[model samples]
Target chain A: MTDVLELRDVHRTHGDGANAVQALRGVTLTVRPGELVAIMGPSGSGKSTLLNLAGGLDRPTGGEVLVEGASLGTLSHRRLSAVRRRTIGYVFQDFNLLPSLTAAENVALPLELDGKSIRAARRAALAALTEVDLADLAHRFPDEMSGGQQQRVAIARALVGERRLVLADEPTGALDSQTGEAVLRVLRERVDAGAAGLLVTHEARHAGWADRVIFLRDGVIIDSSGPLGSADDLLERTS
Target chain B: MSIRHGLLALLERGPMYGYQLRAAFEESVGGTWSLNIGQVYTTLSRLERDEFVLPLPENDGGQRPYEITGTGRAELARWFATPIERTDRPRDELAIKLALAMTTPGVDVAAVVQSQRTAGVRALQEYTRLKTRQDKQAQDDLSWLLVLDAMIFQCEAEIRWLDHCEATILRRTRTARPAEQAQTPEPHPVRKEARR
Candidate 1:
């Protein structure tokens, strides 16, 4: 299987000398196409840092972070941004929607930023929204929707560009259990559609959605256990 | 006793509200396990769904009280007699993190140990304060209080272990330490000569 994301000896550090905080220390990991991997750790354990590096939002201080054999560190800022726009999709914890814009408009923002025609962007956004079963609510603003509805819109936006990899950071943290489960169902559908997903979550229940769960701590993967026969298998093993 | 079975046995006496059941549980058990409100409600709902218990009609339109059904009594009896399967292995994330952090280069094991100790100390102090306040209440629920005591003791033990781990790491790193140097045993002459 072709790897969508690969990290080799990746190191990210904050500060210098005695005051240094090594967020990632010689971390090596990989995510393949159609694979859903959840990175779990306590606060400040560098789970978010790894996601940022993988998505090309931040460069590794040392070593390589490659997406489809393209080295992220070697890409120029403009090139990296373009690659992010065209190939990488991001779903964040806070939804990060425009209150004035409708659900369809928010999902269309990626295409709009990519300089696609307005009509084309709107049509594609509609189709994306329909996939999440939120097409009827496309005209509704973020403030008018529930937490689950807003998250679904964010997910549709992430899937709009046909991006191979989607990076989600605490995607379900803001919603109730039922709503969170619904949103996760949409992400799983996306994965089944051949898109790789890297989910950063603290909740083991949400991580249950992924194909594999990577246990990260202090900026490195400590252990990983996954590809279980079923969700109950995961719950049993972890519980 | 199983938590669900214990709850059913208490409710078998009579239908009672959430707080009343909690109070009864504390009195009977001498306050060992602290049942959070969330856990109680969730268990009640599951039991009701399973037909082991059912909610009785409320009096004066107040909170609903639960009553144990005949099925619940039978289930409770079976639970007391039979042991549930508990083959699952516990995965402690913090321990695993510390284990890996100790092996990884460039990261200071002592710093990791110190930070965990600091956090544990803070948690222990906060838990102690809460315990003091909980103890002074007119209706002090000793059941949950006892649970908190166990948690506090566990935290103290972890902090001590972390201190020892830090000391060991520091001592190992120190130059001219005989034990540290001795760990890398001198190669046997016969085995060493095989390379040449």
Candidate 2:
């Protein structure tokens, strides 16, 4: 199957010269269609950096990032923005919804920004919301919805249109346990329906939604394991 | 999780032979928990001995089925009515490990905490994965879903506890260090300088 998102020896360094901090040091990963890969690591382990790079919000200083077989580094600024708006979806810990927009409008924003007609965008947004079982709340604003509901709207927004790569950073960080699980259920459903996902989370329970998990430390990939692999093996090596 | 109660509950529905009982129990729990036929037979015998169940006449196939007794039905009702007490849980090895690590002379308590946290996280991941697959395959299996949810919640709680342990240990170490420094005599300036 084609990879929905691929990072080939990707490196991102902040600042320059003596002040340079290598946030991601030659990290490589691939998330294929219908796959959800979880990235887990300590703070400053480049989890967010990796997500940002995948989502085209940040550029890698070295190597390549490809979404849907198109190299992100080769794209022009305008083209990259278009790629992000149409092909990549992002769910942040904070939900990142515009307070002024209703749930459906927030979900439709990406499609609209990508030049889809407003009517078409709204229709797609409602469909996405319905996929997440939030169609009834499509008219509600962010503040009007519960944290779980807002996160679901965020997921619906990410999943709207033909966006095949979903990047989530601690998407459940702000919700209660039951609500967090509910959001994960929707994310898992979306991935199972053929969208590839890269979820960066510190919580293992949330990562359990993924088929595989990659552990990072000091900006390096330390270990990767499948759902059935014994986590004790990884712990022994790390400790 | 309780095989005794599980068997009784199955018997409540209808009489079933050993293999049937085992199959029903496994099915109800979504195959997440497997049961051995030998264990089932052993439990059935014990139940018969206790008058909680009675062995019925062998069918044409010669398979003897066990039927729940009136007392068994009452017991099942009591089990359902009573909440499981926390005291009934087994000793927590992780908690004990952390407590011992704090007092052990050569143990790296932080590493211990880290390892436990990693294991907890992994278990949580595995449970969640199971839940996702199970939900997709058997969306209406409430018994299995509940079992999976219980494990997920417990694993989450364990990770949280491990985090709490690490933070508390760090705080205690920080507070204790100054006192230890005050009690220890300062090295002679010449010796300290030579060591440096």
Candidate 3:
């Protein structure tokens, strides 16, 4: 399958040479359709930087980023934003929902930003909300719903349309374990249904949901590994 | 974690012959631990000797079922109430390997840490995958779910410890011992850029 997200030897440095900090250094990764790749590292390890570069929220100082075979490096600012709005879905720790809007409206925001018709956007938003199992609360405001519900709304917003590449940074940071797992389940389901996903989390348990894990250290990927060993191997070894 | 306690717990549910007990044990734990008939019989014999279970007369199929005794009930209750001691676990090989790597000559400690972490994360992911599947089941099955959670938490803790070991080792190597005061010349000091 063609990769929905690709970063070829990507590098991101802040400030001038003397005072520079390389947030990402020569890192390369790929997320194909139906794949969820996790980025795990301590703070300042370039996880967020890598996610931004992947989503075109930030440009790489060197190397290339391609989403769906289109190089992000060469896209115009307007075109890039359009791609970000149209194709990329972002879920952050904080729900990031507008307090004034209802759940449906919050989910519809991304589609609307991409110049989708309000009615069409609402339809897609409702479908996305239903996928997250929160369709009945479509008219509820952010404050009215719990954190998990709000986060699911944010996820619905992120994946409202054909947004194929979902970039989530600590998306489950604020919820309890059960709620957090539920949120991850939704993300995993989306990925399993053919969208590619990139999850940035410090929690190893959350990273377990991904097909592969990339460990970043000092702005570089030290190791990338496939889904952990089978559950049986663990029991046998430990026993 | 003990087969003895596991058998006692299963017998507390109801009477079962050696074969039935083995199948129930495997099915209850999701087949993570398989018990042979010999082991089951050995444990049952031990349980019978200890008066924790009473074996009945052989049935039509030559199956002799056992029931949990009052002492067995008390033992199972105690097992449930008492906390598991950390010292009860087997020696962690990763811990020993890392300690040896730090002290012994010519060991790339960071490499050891990374490789172990790779395996650790893989196992952690698998537990999470199983946990996810378990969550979707119509039945709650609390005991099995808790079992999965324990593995996930322990795996997370081990990985965190490995990360701590790597960081501590790196810091000490860089700060406490410079090349000037080094015991000997480095055998194969890995350059950071070379790894990229």
Candidate 4:
């Protein structure tokens, strides 16, 4: 099967000339259906840049990024936005829910924007919320929910339309431990059901949820290891 | 350390043979702590010697059963009521290693902290994997999940501590070097004067 997300020797740089900052250098990764890959590194090690490139939110300076066998670079702006809307789901550290929208409305926004009927979008949103155990709170606005609950809604939104690729950046950064674990459980369940996921986190315990871990250093892919592999040597050098 | 109390707690339910007690103890703790039959028997013997348990008549197969005494019940109650003191915990080897590394000359302290952090992360991953494999019966598997959570939390705390150690070390060395140089006379001149 084609990978849900693939990055081949991806390079991303900001600015130009001698002053240009290479945010990502020669990083190659793939996330197939049912695989969850974690990107981990120190601050400013290009974790976020890699995620942006994968999501098509930012263009790579070199190499290719493909989603489900289609090259993102070749897509027109309208087509790229459509692909992002229909194929990708993103969960940020902050919930990023619109305060004016109720949970279900927030969740259904993506589907509606993609031109699904409002009724169909709402139905899908309710189904997604039920998957995350938040159906009861569908009518509640973002301000009415706790941080964890809000994050659950965000996850519900991400998974609403059968999006195959989920990208999360420190999705549990703001929550307490128990709440964080609860959110992670929802994320894990979705990925296990065949969604490919790419999570960027500084917390190793959070990365523990991933099937494999990619370690970055100075914009380069330094090491890749299984969840149980000994990281002492790599950690020593990085630390 | 809690094995003695664990056995007594299991016995509180009813009289149990050594093997039964071992199985019950392991089950109650979610099978994370495995108690050998020999260890169970030894603990039972000690409890009997202390009058915390009484040995009943042997069954046809010669399996000996033991029942908790009133004293044992009271002791178990007290154990439940009391808070575990920090001093009672074993010395933290990681903390000791970091402390020593801080003072040792020519030692790469950051490297030591990093190695420990990596090991801690590995352990956290193992615990998480174990948790994932567990049955989804939250009510029935609560004990095991709690034990796993404890390990995960401890590993996370260790990693945070290691990061803190590295940062503090860097900050101190950056700020302390000039002060030390100004305070101490050149060692070479002092050695020469002493030799003369």
Across B60-148, the per-residue lDDT of candidate 2 in tens digits comes to: 99999999999999999999999999888989887887888888899988678766666666677777766766777977888878966
Better candidate number, 2 or 3, judged by lDDT: 3
Better candidate by lDDT, 1 or 4: 4
- The DockQ values of the predictions, listed in order, are 0.03, 0.21, 0.48, 0.19
Output the better candidate (1/4) by DockQ. Answer: 4
Over the stretch B1-196, how does candidate 4's per-residue lDDT look in tens digits? 5688989999999999998998888776665567789999899999999999999999999998999999999999999999999998989988898788888998888668766766666666667767877746465687767877776777788877776776677779989999888788766777799999
DockQ for the candidate 1 complex? 0.03
- The superposed Cα distance between candidate 1 and the true structure at residue A45, in angstroms, equals 0.7
What is the per-residue lDDT of model 3 for residues A1-239, given as tens digits with 9 covering 90 to 100? 79999899999999977999989899988899999999998887899999989999889999999999999999999999899999999998998999999999999988888888999999999999999999999999999999999999999999989989999999999899989989999999999999999999988888989999999999999998896346666667664
Per-residue accuracy of model 1 over A40-147 as CA lDDT, tens digit each: 666788999999999998878899999878998888888888889878889999999989999999999989999999899999999999999999999999999999
Candidate 1 structure quality by residue, lDDT tens digits, B54-87: 8988878587899998899998888778765544
- Best-performing candidate as measured by DockQ: 3
Stretches of candidate 1 off by over 4 Å are A230-239, B1-196
Clashing pairs in 4: none
Considering only N, C-alpha and C atoms within 3 Å, which residue pairs clash in candidate 3? A228-B122, A229-B122
In DockQ, how does model 2 score against the reference complex? 0.21
Error of 2 at A107 (Å): 2.2
The interface root-mean-square deviations, each candidate in sequence, come to 14.1, 7.4, 2.1, 8.3
Ranking by DockQ: 3, 2, 4, 1
